[model samples]
Target: MAARRADLRSALPGLRRTLRYLRPHLRPERWLLAGGFGCLLAEVAFRLIEPWPLKYVIDAVIEPGAADRSGIVALLLLCAVALVAAAGLRALSAYLMTVCFALAGTRAMTAVRADVFAHVQRLSLRFHGSTKTGDLLTRLVGDVGRLQEVAVTAALPLLGNVVALLGMTAVMVVLDWRLALIVVAAFPVFVLASSRSSRKITSAARLQRRREGELAGTAGETLGAITVVQAYSLERILQRVFGADNQRALRDGVKASRLAAGLERKTDLLVGVATAAVLLVGGTRVLDGALTPGELVVFVSYLKGAFKPMRDLAKYTGRLAKAAASGERIVDLLETVPDITDAPHARPAPRFRGELRFEQVDLDYGTGERALRDVSLRIPAGCRVGLVGPSGSGKSTLAALVLRLYDPTGGAVTIDGHDLRDLTLASVRGQVAVVLQESVLFATSVRENIRYGRPDATDAEVEAAARVAHADEFVRRLEYGYDTVLGERGTGLSGGQRQRVAVARAVLRDARIVVLDEAATGLDRESSAAVRDAIRALTRGRTTLVISHVPEEVADCDVVVRLEAGRVVEYRPRALPRRGETVDARRR
Candidate 1:
């Protein structure tokens, strides 16, 4: 997992990658996005127009009797009506904007989530072997949620606020030049303060989001492994550790909140100072007859409206920073290149005859330790081969190579005389089926679990597979029979039952080649025999590699290969002698 973490970290990039993901979404909804833009423009127009009525009511209606009072009354009423209409329209526009933005954002997020999942699926087994399921889940669920927040709250609002600020400022300047100048002077200072505070907030937000992911991952891992925690009597220690992590996350969140709040307060203070300065200078101008009192009032009203968006910008910057951090996390996952990939010109394998050959294959992890050194072997069409080796010898690695789980570091692996690398990964893997030592079942019905290896199999086919694996009798005894629900990872079943279901799965695969990695290692003798019977039935016409230590079972196979320290040490039944049989033992 440490190696996986290093690999993921090394691929991290700057914020530009974050913005690129949003572009495709923006492109598709150009019209709705445009409608959103139009709504924002209309909303800004309403904000700027609101003060016109104040100026009219003050200068014309309030003075009264200097003109036709009835006309003035009607005009004032009309302006009041207009103000109400504007507020209503602004709200409606906001709604329309939200609907459009959410639709676009959701579709875009769906695409991103799909791409991330697909990319993870294509990654090499080596990467998954070292990576934690909890951490990967955190990236999928938590990080994507963050990106959604960025889309809905930050990006959309930023666009609306920017336009509103500009529109309101234009209205303020038109009312009174002297007052506008006084108010505008504070603009640079507010921007500078916001920029400085935002930089700090952005930095803190990035760290805070990372910490949150780690906390989520830790919780997930602990809960998933609750059985281990209880078995080892380490529940108290695990809880304490989780508590410490949660405390650290809380502390970081608080720090982020304080910094964000400070930015809001400081922005408000600057806006207030600007308003005061405008009041002082404009009041003097009105007294000297340089501006009318109504005009001064209208200008101040516009100044207030303009500052609203500025204040909103400051407040929302913190949220935007946090969202951007999340965006970065999601984009990083989406951008991860799979360690294994299909060759561009690769084609699917057709009519598999079950002949497998390892031609001087050299396999190893990135670490200097070798798992296979120049080892070559062959399993003839429709033959059963048993691989026996001590732990850390290359039995499992050899099986993995047959299915191309990890490509050899040197040399080649071929199926039916075609290089494994030259065939599509799906094509190669589809020809081979593996039943692992530990039974992995989903939380689903017994029937569903049996059909997992071949989803398209009919109920009759599934039942036949189950019968062959000796699981049908037990399944039939259950209250719901095949429909009985299995709890998490098939926890509802006994260990032997689970193993049988796994055997049923292999039987259902109907692949040309079958590999069982430590198939009967932990089974009781009776259970092992039942499973072995199923294996024998399934491998009747398929090339098979069974990795086992039980010498009695080893004797049943036509070929028995022994490995020691990552090298083939011996081969049985040499008298049968395929032309190159000696090569298997010579590899070292």
Candidate 2:
């Protein structure tokens, strides 16, 4: 009991911090909150009046010679009507309160979910590579949604009940201080029981939430790689692993339930004990001519009403604890500062002239392995460079720097004399286009997929880009032509077709610089020839970086650079072509 005040003192700061974090979302709903609170107060008032009708009904029957026959009948009718009216108003207030708060909570949570999603997308790739997709999805979808559910149903209703309890207690005190003190004295005992269990319940709930995230992550990971699992015949093994984690999560959930149930039963017993004492003391006082029967009835009714908050506390404590756990997880994710953000004084980059230079750059991926060692290179505007090396020789990592997908751990990458970090990310990425080996396509029409390169492109522009990539012929042969909807990850298309579509996207971008990271690595001979022709069209007059192992592709470049163990081993610059001489002519 002595520790109760200290516990509350410690909890108050955490409560204030939570409210501070929520201020942005809650500020817009001030009016709705006002309406809800007003209804809540009205509900409490009606509840206080609810017991008076019964008191008057009892007193009228007990009191001798209180009024004449007609007078008594009118009084009885008035009490009955008042009783029904109070109940109706109270019901109306409760309904309005629930609606108003529910609307507020829903709108706030919806906004929170959107903000979390946008922030997560903006976070750097390093953050994503380390975190599980299913864990993020859980926090963004399930955890935030749980907070909304609890706020509207459990938390808001509990607030109303607490108010009602306070109002009822005030009336009880006015009726008879002795009985009021008796009911109030039970509070310390109630607090003692709940304070110890609250921490245990919250801890249990937090552990359970973590377990659930792991369970979801395992399931999502296994399902995502079903082909690999099947190829390896690992279904039963993986299922057993998932089942064990699932069982662990179940045990955690049950532990929380048991703790909450134990607290609630203790509260129920306390309520019963307090009520018995109230009845005994009040009845004795009445027998001694110290209290009237109507007043005694009022005290008994108030006793029941006053104990309600305690009963509700027992009912909602565990649920609220879990909700609190979910809330903390969301806050942690929202608080994660992105590893990369524009500097305070950074401005939108101007149109790049495509002159790129890497100045003794070094990159260490936080692991022991250094991705790139003190590498220095220069490529003039409109130059095509071929990068070749063994696997993990930092080919893609170097291209990533030009896009500022990552910053160098040691030195800087610059375009046209400006460090990439000095410019905004959107501006840098906007002027650079990329065609990866396995480009992803959404379940949308062929036209929409091409338009993803430039969202505002017209149909004519999209078709022109497709023609340049040699994709127009095959795309036209499809049943829906440009309107044909592809399956997830472009399942309906052949590998060469998908590659051509990606090239079409890059063509539509019309950026000053392009990176083809083995874009034609997996194509057959005929497909490779068509794609090379398309690449020639795309890279003409643009600064291009091609990461490939094909000798013929490397032969077409103006410069060939090779890396050995993340260090440049060979740098050879070939002479420029003669006037009006195409790359194919030079090759022949």
* Model 2 pairs whose backbones collide: none
lDDT of 2: 0.85
Cα lDDT tens digits for candidate 1, 1-588: 121122123122434577677687568768877887787787777766767777877778556365887878898898899888877888888888888878877877777778788888888888777777766887787777777876687667766766766776676677676677776777667766666666677777788887777788778888888889899998889888889888888887888789879988998899888888888889899889887777888788778766766676677766777776787777777777776678899998887988888888888787798888898887777777889989889899999987878999999988889998899998888778888888898999999998988889999999999998889999999889999999999988887788889889888988899998877778888888877787787777678888988787677777889999878888885345343433233445
Question: Per-prediction TM-score, please?
Answer: 0.92, 0.93
Per-residue lDDT tens digits for candidate 2, residues 1-588, read 232332233233434555567779988999999999999999999988988888887888778787676877888899999999999999999999999999988988988899899999888888888988888988999888888887887878878877877788888888889989999899888887778787787788888989998888999899878889999999999999999999999999999899889988998899899989989999998888788888888888888888777777677767777777788888888888887789887789998878888888899878888899988887777888898899899899999999888899988899988898999988889899999888778899999999999999999999999999999999999999999999988879998898889889999999999999998888899988888888889989998999987767788888888887788888766766334322211110
Query: Which prediction has the highest TM-score against the true structure?
Result: 2
Residue runs of model 2 more than 4 Å from their true location after superposition: 1-16, 65-70, 476-481, 577-588
Candidate 1: residue 271 Cα off by (Å): 1.1
C-alpha root-mean-square deviation, each candidate: 5.1, 3.8
Q: What is residue 227's positional error in candidate 1, in angstroms?
A: 1.5
